[model samples]
Target chain A: MKLEEFKEREKRRKFLKEISVIAIGTAVGITTYLICLITHFDIFGWNFGLVLSPLFAGYAESFLAKKYLEESTGAVSAFILFIITVVWGFIISNPTLGFNIITAGSIIIIIQAAIPTATNYFLIGMTLAIISHISGIFKKITNFFYKRYLQLMGKLNLDPRIIREENAEEKYHFYETEPDMNHLGVLLLTLEYLPQGKELIDNKGIYEKREIFTFNQREELKSMRKNEMHLKLMASVKKTETKALYNLIKELKNDGCNAVLNLHMTFETLGQDKGENVRQIIVRGTGVVLADKTDS
Target chain B: MLLSSTSTLDNKKITKYHGLVNGEALLGTNVYKDLFSGIRDVVEGRTSTYAADVQNARDEAFKSMEAKAEALGANGIIGIKVSYNNLGGTMGNTILVTAYGTAVSYEK
Candidate 1:
């Protein structure tokens, strides 16, 4: 064969290899997205524009990886591509399906396939089946929980900010604000379920201790902590809390609340202290009031 | 010396502030570390409810910026910036993080 012809053949072979890698990656991504959609009924109700996001995202990601990694796109990269695809799929899907099951299944399959004695064909088939099955089940369960929670929230006259799927691997953090101070009273009215005050409220509608954080008390605490590390901490805390509060207020505005009367921050803390730092800060003025009137 | 491969004509210096580095590797050291820490915080319930989504947005931004830098052939990214915005009415939040730096080709 002529030297130029040989070079052309080599180039074509390299091109084919690159194309195959991209094609495989795209296939994995698309299949995962489809499985998630099939099991999640809420996803089907999403706007068409949102549904196409994962497809486009997957194609772009695969193309980019192929262009850059070329023949060196290792298994790790492929896995990362899979993760990226799943995340994008969740984002694009309506109601946002949690990826814990999908992620766990993918990891398990990858680990199994990495075993020296594992057969390639067996691994591939097993992984594909497991991924599809888990993805579908997770989507269905998540959708069921989400719908139930939303319905409950609607019935309670309480707006649910986020409806996270109940999964063993899933953790939730929520911050809410009481704009009219009326909600504060209501929260206190139902303090039986609250974390700190859960044990305080009895059937008689009485509490061991009625802790309230008024708007004025909050401002005073902020002023006191102005020069301390607590100030910075409070600033960051309030930023997120205020956001959650703002969103809640927007939802409740038509129902009558001019301003957020108070704010509540609930999060899980790490370490042996279970978030001692946060507890110390919030406990300082746990029941203080910030403002009185809705306009205030 | 048959120097047939020396095809250097006009090279432009592209300095990207907070551009991506590590070749095609996505996520700079600081950005990745910060992102993981944020994620950890969310997982640990140390953050507010929206922190997880915020962290995800931050991660996505880093990935996006890295992709852009890769397209530009950048060596390292510096001067990174991250910002957040909320799409009201239960749509959740959006985070925008940018990494930029100069793209340079070193001659050996």
Candidate 2:
């Protein structure tokens, strides 16, 4: 074959590979969904929808994994689908029955899956069932915790207010602020530390500074900073902070404070690695005072 | 004997200095160091994405200031200070860079 033809063939092969992966992903998703729908033994008043949610979840997860994750497995997809099936089963079933079955089933499945066996189908199914059941329980617990968290935030005196001023020409200036002292002052000021890595450098030729173990090496960095996931998280965090600060500033202005002094401090903590798990805490404080010269 | 130009324009003493040159002249060693350090922090792991963003903001502010200085026929700017509110919550990580400097005209 000519060089150009050979290159074209290689390109076609690569294209085919990608297409096949996508096809496999779709098949895994559809098969998992169908399996959950079929194998669903409605024990303890669990409806079809509730039992089938996990299958749908698993399929969706598999599809996403195929698209995002480098490695895609039919077995993993099936397992995830099965687990979702069980979780949904618990969700729809009677609370007592679901919890008991899930807890017991999950332990058994986890143990069985951990062990190597030639006939792994039964063990895999059991493991998936157990995981789903436990996940359902977790969902309930997390939901409860989330509700309580919101309630606690509300009780912490987070009074977000909007003040509009109409000028002589009927022009209005709107000022929005959050007056929750606890939320703004205490909650955000705290910082979490992330550990990057350590390095040893000889300071023979350098200045008086002998040696320093700085976390500045590019090779030591583990977290992917420029990824879409990190960007989304950053955007969310920025939006929250902006809203809070905007509200606080507005409130201060409404209270007849003309001048505001904002002090920002950032400090790194010891231990932990980069990413959400370990982050530098930035503390920003806004002091609102009367614009009178005497206050200065 | 030297023949001096006896024109009325001679009294005006026109000194031609490019705006770019004037801006450079106005830059303090410390301010330049700080700017470089800020840029380095953005490039390094010491700073977050927000810090890089702030650095970009500062650079843009300086560029605009330079343009304004040129329009005003000022030779340089001094005593620059940048300040902005650090909003909190998830979004508080965003840093707003605001730079202000005194613009002055220098005679060459």
Highest TM-score: give the candidate number.
2
Residue A154 of model 1: what lDDT?
58
Q: lDDT per residue, candidate 2, A1-296, as tens digits?
A: 69999999887975565455445544554565565457753455443333233333334444554565544333343354445545554565435555434443344334334642422454356457667675786567766985775476456432121111111012211213323332232111110110011111211111111111123223222212221222232333333433444454455445543322322333232333442223333324433332212322
TM-score of chain A of 2: 0.21
**DockQ metric, candidate 2:** 0.01
The candidate that wins on lDDT is 2
Local error of candidate 1 at residue B46 (angstroms): 40
lDDT (0-100) at residue A6 of candidate 2?
93
Q: Report how far off residue A88 is in candidate 1 (Å).
A: 2.5
Candidate 2 chain B: minimum summed lDDT over ten consecutive residues — where? B19-28
**Model 2 residue A28 lDDT?**
59
Give per-model TM-scores.
0.20, 0.22
Give the Cα lDDT of each candidate.
Answer: 0.34, 0.36
